[model samples]
Every structure is written in C-alpha cells, then in structure tokens.
Target: MPKPRGRGTSAEPRRTVKASSGSARARRQGKAGERAGAKAGPPAALRDRQERAPASSRARPRKAKAATSLAETAVVKRPAAPEKRAAAERPAAPKGRPPRARAGDQASAAPPKRRPRNAKAKSGADDAELSPPRPPELDWDDTPSESAEEVLAQRWAARGEELFQQLEGHGAALHEYRADLKEGRFVWIAPNGRVSAEASARLLCSWSCATSVLVMAWADPLVSGAEIERIDGMPAEQDGVDEQGAWQIAMRAADACNAAYLYRVSSPQAWYFLALDGLTFSPKRTSFHPGAPVGLVLRAIGEVREAIASRAEPADVVRDRISALSDSLFHQARYAYRDTDWVARLDRTGSCLSHLAKRIPRAGFSAIAAGQRIDEWLERELALELINALSLIEDEWSLFG
Candidate 1:
C-alpha cells in the first residue's frame, strides 16, 4: 500500500499502450460496420430509400386525376383519342360505295344530245352580238381632216359644184334655144331632148317682125354672141295692145332707153338702141363739100350715094362715100344675084367697103339708119329717098365725065 515514486512513471507508460490499442480496435470495428451495411442492402440514406422501390410493381396505386406539374405533387387526368362511329349512324354514305347518280342522270350521262346546229349557232351568235359600232376615233396630230365630219360636209357641198362644171363642159347643149325673129320661129339645138311648144311660141314671138336678112344672119348657122345678148335683153313690147298702137309702146321703150343711157354710158350694151335711133346723130369724120347739095343730103340721111354727087369733095370723103355705097350694093347683090360672076364682083366691092367703113366712124351711119325706125312712114320715105339719092348719084358719076 504505501506507494513508490518510480512506480508512478511505469504505470503512465502502460496506460499509453492501452490507449493506442483501444483506438486501433475502434477503427477496425467501424470498417467492419461499413462492410456489413454494404452486404446487407441499400443504406438508410434519403436518395437510396427513394430509389430502392420497384417502379412498375409499386405497392400503392396513384389517384385517377390529371397531373399538373412535374416538380409539384398535384396530378391530372388526360383525354383519350376519338373513335369512329358505325356507318348506319352517319348521314353521308360510306367510303366503299360509289356516289349516288345525279337526279338528271339520263341528261348528264351517255352521249350528250346536240340540238339542231343552226339553231344553237344562231342563239350563240345573238348572245355574242353587242351594240352598234361607234364612229372611228380621229388622231388630231396625224389625220388629214382634223374633224372628219366637217371635212365630209365640205366635200359633199363641193361635189355638186364640181359635177355641175363637168356636166357644163361635156353634157350641156352646144346650141340651145335660138330665136330667129325674121323667120318667126324658134330653133332648139339639142342632142336628144325635144323643144316644148311654149318655148317655141315664146321664141317665135321674139323673132316675129324681124327682117329676112336679119333672120338669115341670126338663124342660118351659129348666131353671133352679141346678138344672143340682145335677144335675151329684148322684152316683149306686146302687153295687151292699147288704142294708140305699137308706136306708142316703141316710143316709151325708146324713151326709157334714152333716159337710162345717160347713167349707163360705160355699158354700151344698155344703150344699143341709142346708136340705132336717129335722135342722136354722130359727127361725120370726113369733110365733104360745104356748098354742095350732095353734102347736105348726105348729112341728113347718111347716104353715101348722096355724098358722092358733090363736086370738089375732099379725097377722103369721096373715097369713103363711094366705098360705103358700093358695099351696100354688094351686100344686096350677094342675096339677090344668082350669077357667079356677080358674086365675085359683089365680094370685091364688099371688101373695098369694109376697108372704108373701118377707116370711117360708123356712129353717124348707124344713127341715120336707126332714125328711120322712129315712124313707119318715115322709114318707108327715107328708104325711098335713099334709093333715089343713090340712083341719082350713081347715074351722075358713071354717065357724066
């Protein structure tokens, strides 16, 4: 029992050895525990417990409901796929059978029957026909007639005038109605048309009472252009004859012409009668004998023959007077004389007279001849005086000296 100091140290060593052995034994036991747990089964850890259960042969059953989210505990139910119904329950026919034929099966099937071709074509054509055509559009920049309608109207109007000119040139009658007053007849010269009786009577009336020579001159062949103008201008003087006679009418017409002549000197055609009337005597161009009775006679009646009776007459006067008288005789002989020899002589004389007349002024001669028409008695008397005077002058010139 009483303890020693050295013994205390020895005991400490032993205690240290013992403590080491105990720590070794403890580590071994721990390793044995880990090996036992591995051999036995999964550990009692959270992950191991959860994974240990058989997924398909779980002991508990899930509730019949729709699953909401994967992370959440909630569950949900899913809808199933739709199924087909029996054919009897459907309204439309089933797919196996062909579709029922149309109600108008005969019309739709077989060969389509054609109507009469003409009738079908006509109906189609009628349907296709549209409204009447409109007028053509005009190109203002390029077309010749900017406004076609206006140009057409102008052309239509001008066509008539052009046709008229063409007809006038070729189809118009060359010789139309010509009145020969001396012959008392109207002659119409046309290729085919007949002259009307009314026109004939009118022409005859115009030509009536004219001299035979005048008729031959105007009606024989082609009438003179101036003569035609005269005929046209001549108005019918016979307007229900009054008691005074034709002389009064003639005087009145003559007076009117005389009055109108003053204003219309430029238009000689208007005053043609002035030269024919004796009231206005033109001055003689050639000088005759002042004292000679022949000159006096010539001045009064414009008779060339009377002028030739004078002695010491101017050469021009004598020549002119002789030439005029010779011309008158020749003109008379042309119609009166049947002999060829006489015709030649008349022609020669007429040529000489023509030359003289050209040189001399004819106004005086025309006036004297015109004066005779003032009175019928005067005309006859002057004509007789002219013949006597001419005869005397001719006899005196030829027989004397």
Candidate 2:
C-alpha cells in the first residue's frame, strides 16, 4: 500500500490547507474587522497564513454571514409563541368586488377597481335606488308568420241571406231558430270534399257549437304583437290566431253572413258579457284578451311551452303559471295536484257548454247572472282546450310540469 501524506507536511511541493478552511478563516477575519468598534470584539487570528494574503483580498462584512454563523454556533431560544405578535390582532380582508380588468378585458390581471365618482358613500334603501334599473321589456320570442291556411275549424258562414234571416234571432231564441233550421233542407260541404246531404241536427249543433267556439276565439284572439307585450315568453303563433288575423277571419265570416247583427237584439251576449256597454256592435271586438278565459289560458299554455323549450325560466315561474291556469281554467283550482279532482274538472269542461246554452236564454232576466254564467262556461271551455293541448305533451312533465 502507498503511504498517506502527514498533516502540515512540507515534504512535497503541494498545498496542505483546504480551500474551504482558508475561505472560512478569511471570512472570520473580515467579520472580526467589522466588529472592531464593538466593546466585546474578539482579537484577530494573527501569525497565520492569512497575514500573507493581500489587504484587498479581505471579504466584505455580510449580514447573512453573521446571522448564519449565530444560528449555527450560538442561539437565544424563543418562547413557543411571541408575546408582542400574539397581542396584536390582524384585520380582516375588506368585503367588495375583486379587482377587475380594464375595458376589452374581463380578467383579474388589472388593478383593483375603484368605485365610480358618483357612487353613494352611504348604504341602505338608497343603495337599491342606485342599482342599475332592469329593462322595461322582457325578451320574448318573435311571433310566427300567419299561414295561408288556418289551424282551427272552418269559419262560420251562412248558405245565403235566407239562412241569415232564418237564424236572425239565433242569439236570442236559439231553440226556435234551431227548430226552424232543423225543418229546412240543407247540404253540408266539408273542406276535404265530403258531402252530407242528410246531416242530422246533432251534427249541425256540434258544428254550430264549434263555430261559436270560433266566435269565442274571435272575441278573445291569440298571440299578436300587442298581446305579446303582455305575455312573457310565449311561443309564436303557428297560424292565423292573433288579433289582426282573427279580425280578418271574423270579417270574412261576417261578409258571408250576418251573425254580428244579433248584438242589436236584446240578448245575454249583447251587453256587458261579450259586448262592452256603449260600444258600436259594428265589427265589435275586445282588446283585453287577458280577461277572457280562453285567451288567457291559451296564452298561459304558450308560456308553459316557452318555459319548456328554453328552460331558462325558473321552475317556480312555470309552476306559478300552472297554478294560474288552473285557477282560470278549472272550477276548483288547487296548488297540489293530488288535492284536485282532475277527472270531475275535466268532465265539467265538456258539459259546461250545455249548461251555458241553457243559461243564455234564461239570462234575459239577469244580466249579472248571465255574465257569471258566461265566465263559468269560458273557464270550462278553456279547461277542455288545455286538456286537449296537454295530452300531446304530458310526457314532458319533468321539464315544464
């Protein structure tokens, strides 16, 4: 084995002192020079190799060296917690919107935003007053274009002036007029080219009832630009169902017949119910469809459809609509579905028209009673219509039920 070099050996021309030891010794010397003014300063390590080094070779006094050296070699232990720091309480963060980016940027990299110069310094009801105003108009869907063909049954028209004269008193003495109409020779022509030369009075009455429903539709109307302003989130009409369209349909029928002339007679429908007091019966109409049961319920149904399609509307809004529709359409409105007798209500809707027909002539004695009866009849009719419409979409209950 080769011999190891001895400590402080000068046998060979090689350095014995380590580079790290020399650097540490130089650092100690520099520290001692910096602490020379202190009363407790220690003497420098003289008569060593450090004396040969150049004066300029001394390292500068460093705070890091002192702290590290004290930490490693000397330490004054601290308590588990500092008394002064524990005594002082830190303030909570301020509550407000975080800093926002400048215009053209919606990020948080920008500086904290300051309140507007005009912002109110105090908070209370005045804060609400300072808040941004909501828009006056709601975002409603566009009304659909009217189609050339209508979605409803055929418009009511007389065969001739003779038929008009025969049923001139149909609104008053509907029964006598029906008897007269029953005795007459008639030919029924359907839109699909079907001919019924021997159509029964039952068929005629059913058709007439359906036609009267068209009158009901005309009296109330459906989705129109004016109506849209009042109805929030309603689907556009699929055909001629709105005000102008309904007027056109009614006018076309009026041109072909004289059904509107009956209002001139003393009847239940002539005053306060369908016709307004002091209004000319000449193409008489109502602008307030929300009051009309058929119109309101139909519009509410449209709103439900819109709620279903967009789903942006809250469930509570849709549920509220259902409750309102039930109140207007059904006899006994209840919030809970289980609480209602849906079957009886549905049956009442179909049979209420008969009760209405019976009550119309009797209404000659009491216009007030007649008005109430008409309201009831309208509710039933609306309910029946709603029932029919909902049947096709009942499966979508999870969305808008």
Candidate 3:
C-alpha cells in the first residue's frame, strides 16, 4: 500500500513532485507519447461519449495528449465526455417534446456489468483504454484447424482412402495412404504399402494401361458376343487393381483376341485376301473366289510377280504353322478327327510349311524393313516357287479346318 499524503485544513489542492524539465528522458518520452497518441486516435469509450456530446462542445477540439515516461507527468485537458457533461451542456428538445435522456443517465439505471473471465480487473484510468475485455469463448469469428486425418475424413472419405485388397494370387496388393490436404493431392501407395515415387508411378501406369485394355476388349472385333457376357459378370471393383491383377486382366483380353482371330482364316470358305484382293498388277475385283490347288496356286504366282504385293514374312508364317499343329487347341481338334486321311493331310501340310519357313534368309531380313521397302532378293524365281508352294499347302489345310 502507498502512504497517504496529508491535506491541509485550509482546503488547499494537493501538490506533487515534478521531474527536472531539462532531463533528456523527460523530453524524449513526452515527444514519443505525443506521437503515439496522435497516431492511435481517441479510445472507443471516449469516441462514443464525444459523438453524444453537444456539437458546440465538439467544436472546441481537445489538444493531443502529452507524452512522458511516467503517465503521472503527462498533463492534458480534454473537453468533458458527453456522459460526464451537465444537463446545461445538452441541446434542448423541440417544442412539445420532453427533454431527451442522456446515455450516462440510462447506463446509471442499468445493472453493473459482469467482467470477462481470465482478464484481471484493475483500478484507475487504465480502464479507459482496455477494460471489460471479451472472453475468447464468446468470440465466434475464429475457426479451429483440424489434423491431417480429420481433414481427410471430412473432405475425401466417401470411400475410405486407406483401402486394401489383394490382387489375384500375387503377393502384390493395391493399398492406400492418408491424403495430402494442403495441396489437395492423393498419393498412389506402392503395392507393398510403402511410399516410393518411381515404383508407385510404375504401378499406377501399368494398372491404368491394363484396365484400358480390358475395357477396350468390349469394343474390339476380336471379342465375340459370348465373351461380352463374361465381361459383364466380372466384379464391380476391388479396392483398386494392383500390378498383378492388371496382368491377369491383360491376359484375358489377349485370350479373347486370339480366340476371335482363329476363325479369321480358319477354312477355305473364310479365305482372307492372301495377297490378291487389291494387289494384282491391274487392280480389279473378281466375283469368283479362288478354289483349291490350281486357282490358289495361280493367285500366289501372280502375287510373286507383282512388286508391291503384301507377302507374309516367311519367319512369322513358318512359326505360326508349326505352333498351330503342336499347340493344345490344334491337338484337341486333331484328336476329334477319326479319318486317318485327314490326319495324314494335316501332318503332311505342317511338314511342308515348316520346310518353307526354314528357307527364309536368317541374316539381313527384317519384316518391318521388308514391308516398308521392296526386297530385291525376294524377287528371284526361287522365292516365287516357294511362295506358290506355301499357297498350295495352305489350300490343303483350309479344307481340313
């Protein structure tokens, strides 16, 4: 507690100690405070009171507050706040109207206000600047930030992001991770549930490609109407297809394509234009289809004579013929045949095609290059004889199918 100063009985006003006027701090501090008060403007309570005061009193503008290191040393006079003004200072009401009540009178009649929690109360004029502070709980404008998990759950969790599903029988799986909320990006988790940029990207791309292939099978001519039913029967989706599952999808697509293609050139009746469709020296259409041995051999000879006839690459043609005979599908079809003559014909045709495949040049032969540019060596009479022989053998197999 501070010691009380005694007052004289003569009713003299109280006197206080003063700092030396010449002190450097007193001069600096007075100027600093004067500048601060000028920049800050009047406090809210003082502004409200000023607004209600008579215009005449407001006309007499108050001087800026004085500055000093000690608040006590600062002395300045202000026009009385409207709430503190006497009744004489107010403007009179118009005729027939009762005198208007002042804000101070109304406040005096109201209940004393409650103080905010956590804010300490103090006595004195410090209350003029910042008293009756608001509690944080009552401030409705502020928003709270959520954690990463909470953010994902709120925005991106229709189907939970951290999903898991096994891919076929492979050890690899499609899994997930929490989202990156700041950038609004979702990372592709690796097959093993680890974060790896390269592996994850590769997995993502492979899955995308295989899914596209499977979807494209619906549009491919290779897939028959029956195959479309199988596609429809597939499950809606798992968590997400992983690398292994994508491979399996791609394999099914391949099977559909291969199965459809088998009938493309299966028999003599389904003959694809071997080379004669539009490749003759004089391009002309003929209604008559080529019949076995003689007619097929004549078309083959015409193809060899032409410089621009599309020839099947000998290497590819031979491999296909030999693989067909030894492959499972062909073996099953062959087992169905009880006629020894048909079986013997198949064996004999396979041997003939295999012999022709071996005759193609091993070195300096490129299917792509040969197709793009004319093959000078293949124009020879020997290559012509081989091409005709292939046609004759293919004609025989066409009847077998």
Model 2 poorest 10 in a row by lDDT? 202-211
The true-versus-predicted C-alpha distance at residue 106 of model 1, in Å, is 86
What would the per-residue lDDT of candidate 2 be over residues 1-401, giving only the tens digit for each residue? 55568765666467656565544664665555445423333323322222344554334234434543453232223244566656555444457866544666855456779977566545545877888988798667677655433422223222334344543433211221111122221222222322312211111100011112222322233322211112222222223244344444433333333332211111111110111112121212211111112333334455555544555434333334444344334432221121334435433432442332332222334756646443312244444444455544333332322
Tell me the spans in candidate 3 whose CA falls farther than 4 Å from its real position.
Answer: 1-341, 361-383, 397-401
RMSD of 2: 31.4
lDDT against the true structure, per candidate, is 0.35, 0.34, 0.36
RMSD of each: 28.3, 31.4, 30.6
Q: Highest lDDT, which number?
A: 3
User: Ten consecutive residues with minimal summed lDDT in candidate 1?
Assistant: 262-271
Q: Please report the TM-score between candidate 3 and the true structure.
A: 0.22
lDDT of 3 by residue, 76-163 (tens): 3545667768665767679998776689987778777888653554434557566686767665655766754454334322222222
Which model, 1 or 3, shows the larger TM-score? 3
Model 3 pairs whose backbones collide:
30-67
lDDT of 1: 0.35
* Model 2 error, position 18 (Å): 99
For model 3, the local distance difference test gives: 0.36
